[model samples]
Target: MRLTVRTNIAMRALMTCAVNPGKIVRKAEIAEATGASEAHLGVVINQLAQTGFIETIRGRNGGIRLRLPPEEISVGRVFRTFEANTPFAECFSARDNHCPIAPVCKLRNSLDTALEAFYASLDRVTLSDLTCNNAGLERLLSLEPVC
Candidate 1:
């Protein structure tokens, strides 16, 4: 299943925060690092914050940080949150399904299995796992000099 831009950026944003835990990360910095537009970052950030994965602070000291520990934030949960309403195919969507063989479509079941495996794989990893011991990721996401 192709992940949406939101999912990609949301993971990036979370990784950015995870790598810099205890420090608040500005949206502009995240945008600069991930190459996401402010508009896209704004929407993703709001969704992430609303879901209680990350916390946001406003004003001059404004920035974002993870609310829960990185290990507690499951990647599968994040992916599911953004992709809950998204359908894998036309047959997957109840309102827009025009396929004639929707009843006997083995393809849908196969796709469902594959999608479940995908999430299950992601479920094993967390924000901390994504950034753990990865100097490159830490370097890429960090606004401060790598020590």
Candidate 2:
């Protein structure tokens, strides 16, 4: 049930925007903060924008910002948007599964339940929940104190 590097980057980018609400964050800054390559961050940022999670302004003064309030962006929803095609286990993917017992495998069902529980827990948290009252995160990201 490991998350892809891209999914991890997307969450970091979103959290960067969440902590610095109302300001346009540069892609370079996000790349720097998240420790993702600029090229990779570019793709993830575009995907995030297209998914209605963030807004992008293209120009000399352009950058990115959260399209919705932090409280409105569910962590689970973001995860689903990027992870829709990700198979948790080889048995989860019909095209990739070669296990002979897949049809009657109890492990698959157990893994499914575990995956659902993972998402269910995430569903309880929003971007705001991840960033609330976290001064250390603000410092690490170099965000100004929210007034």
Name the candidate that leads on TM-score: 1
lDDT of 2: 0.89
Model 1 clash pairs? none
Cα lDDT tens digits, model 1, 1-147, are 589999999999999998887899999999999899889999999999999999999999899999999999999999999998899899989999999999987999989999999999989988888899999998888878755
| Count of clashing pairs, candidate 1 | 0
Give the 10-residue window scoring lowest on summed lDDT in candidate 2.
138-147
Give the root-mean-square deviation of each candidate in angstroms.
1.3, 2.1
List TM-scores for all candidates, in order.
0.94, 0.93
Give one digit per residue, the lDDT tens place, for model 2 in 33-139. Answer: 77889898999999999999999999998999999999999999999889978988889887999889988889988889988889889988999998889988877
lDDT of each: 0.92, 0.89
Model 2 misplaced stretches (Cα beyond 4 Å): 143-147
- Candidate 2 Cα RMSD after full superposition onto the native fold (Å): 2.1
